[model samples]
Target chain A: MVEKDVIVNSDAGIHARPAMMIVREAMKYPCEVMLIKDSVEADAKSIMSVLGLAIISGSKLTIRAHGEGETELVDFLINLIEKDFRV
Target chain B: MRKLTVRYFIEGEGRIDLQLRLYAGEGGLDKEIKYGEINRPGLALAGFFDYFAYDRIQIFGQGETAFMNQLSYEQKMKTYSDFFSYDLLCCIFTHDYVPDKLFLEFAEKKNVPIFLSKRGTTRFITLFVHVIDEIFAEQVTLHATLVDVFGVGVLLTGKSGVGKSETALELIERGHRLVADDMVIVKKIDESLLMGAGSEILKHHIEIRGIGIVNVREIFGIRSVRNRKRIEMVILLEEWDSAKEYDRLGLDDKKYSILDIEVPYITVPVRPGRNIPVIIETAALNQRLKKIGINSARELDEKIKKWIMTEGQK
Candidate 1:
């Protein structure tokens, strides 16, 4: 398993558009991805689970992935967040 | 777990049940209630602060109220000052007994909230303890679906797309009830029972992959939804593994621990042809039968052992 913590720097936080982008990016990988905030883990591949986190600006979240391509998946997700979901 | 504030306790359902009306100390509404026990300041009023449980919520019943009425004006003033010296959480006046103006003044000066209850001393304490216990209970939120199957609360858990919500939807169509979907808040009550409920924002809403967010209550009606249920069993739906062994005899008991309470756990492997909902319904019924002292697997083993022994004797 691989995990990386990133702070949400977007001005608007993770609303429907950003959450959908995260979920879409996560579903491309075969490994299991999860987003954890404050001890509650949400599936990164599920939009509902990601939105349920209610993550706002300046929120610290851990991007975690397990199984095949775990490290790359985590790095890819952290890069996405760092870029403010630009891609 | 979050801190329990004085304002939250008063705003909860216990407010109406206990007839709690705030008398003073509006500034202290944000004060934290650190303990669940209730304390009566009968001894504190007598000018003895030794071993005083000052942090607990103080209750002034008929005995303490009558005692204060008999004290001299100077003594009453002294007693009020002495009582409010400690960093008390709050105080309650029971049986419709209102505190004197001096007492409220002291409480307000100390920024300690004071509440009045119409219930008798004993009744108020019993109900207050019950409500406070729930507030301080250990809680955790899980990414799972909780459904009521045949009067048994079964928590469905697995990976994201492992059919947890789909199975719950089928169970609801088969005359069961849905408690929560996607996120279930499970609280350990009284150290023995685990109560599962839906989150305030996602209550009774199921998000099917293709169907988007659907209101279960609107589609399934009122009988198909419940606000909360005691979690009795946990079912984990996983993709069928070709090499892994599954429990076929139901002999070895599997347990899933949530908040330190162990509940019966079963792993159901999902496949194309298997009927997951019916299996869950049967599991719930089997749990109820076990609760009533009937162990089908053990009973069958015992019967078979007796028959083999008689045949060997013959």
Candidate 2:
């Protein structure tokens, strides 16, 4: 698994909109991924639990990926978050 | 391959038998029955309160409808809607399910076999037409390769020179019946079942390196080449590779998804000395064992784990 930490910066604070975007990206990559926040692990591809976290700005979230194309998936997610999750 | 069939019961007058294969309906048994012919049968108008037995009947709509043509389409249809007293009726959705008055009446008379689908006109016709045929299809199971190993039907697959033909030849020699050779045309009658047929181009024929293409039926006779077989398992043969690490423990149950359905896949690495036919038979048996809730590989793994646990305790 490739793990990386990113701080939530979007105004929505990783709510439904951003969670759905992450789910869409995760599905495109053939890898098992989980998003961890404050010791709680939520399936990154699931929009419901991700929204449950209610991650506010500056909350550091660790994204871990495993399986085929896990490294590339980490790079892609990193790029997506670094760019402030534009889409 | 065993072809699955569906039968639909329809309500019509003089028991105007119309065979229709059932597709899903819109609501409950209370939906309108839309048939190709609008003309209502006499019994539909008279109501089944006096004398009726079977739930529905099957008719050949594509054939001559001598009785149906005698009365006006609207008049015959009225026999069901205006005259018949039943709330629901069986309907034969031949080719279409649009809102038509005559069709609705007949459906109201019979209480079962209501047809409903969101499919357009042409698709409904093609599907229903086949359904009718299936209900009346001649009952005959053709010859085919049938092996009861591991409880799953394992169909060997490979391109020419990939050794499907050679593997099958060896399998038959080992006392297994040949289902189909060269081309296995699979058909999805429903979920959970898939059947295969040999293509006409290479039916019962196997090509060996020196012997060229030879007809298994001609050489092995009728007792050898089977006409069809139910495919419960699939074994794909690929050219052997020293670099490719094959699954040895039988854990992980590698799955090869075909036509949206996942089947347990065992890729046999092909080489000159490898006895693929024997290996594939074992794989088919293993899959069957798994289906019946007995996983030998998992059981062995558990046994090993228990041994390790005992050693640690000591």
Which candidate leads in TM-score? Answer: 1
Candidate 1, residue A29: the lDDT equals 85
lDDT, candidate 1, A1-87, per-residue tens? 898999999998898899888887788888988899888888888776787788899999998899888898889889888999896
Misplaced by over 4 Å in model 2 are: A1-87, B1-151
DockQ for every prediction shown: 0.56, 0.01
Weakest 10 consecutive residues, lDDT, candidate 2 chain B?
B1-10
TM-score of structure candidate 2: 0.47
Measured over the true interface residues after superposition, the C-alpha RMSD of each candidate is 1.7, 24.0
Which residue pairs in candidate 1 have backbone atoms (N, alpha carbon, C) closer than 3 angstroms, thus clashing? none
lDDT per residue as tens, model 2, A1-87 = 789988877665776566667877887876778777775555565443355455788889888998888888878777777677874
Count of residue pairs whose backbone atoms collide, per candidate: 0, 25
- Given candidate 1, what's the lDDT at residue B68? 96
lDDT over C-alpha atoms for residue B160 of model 1: 81
DockQ, prediction 1: 0.56
TM-score of 1: 0.93
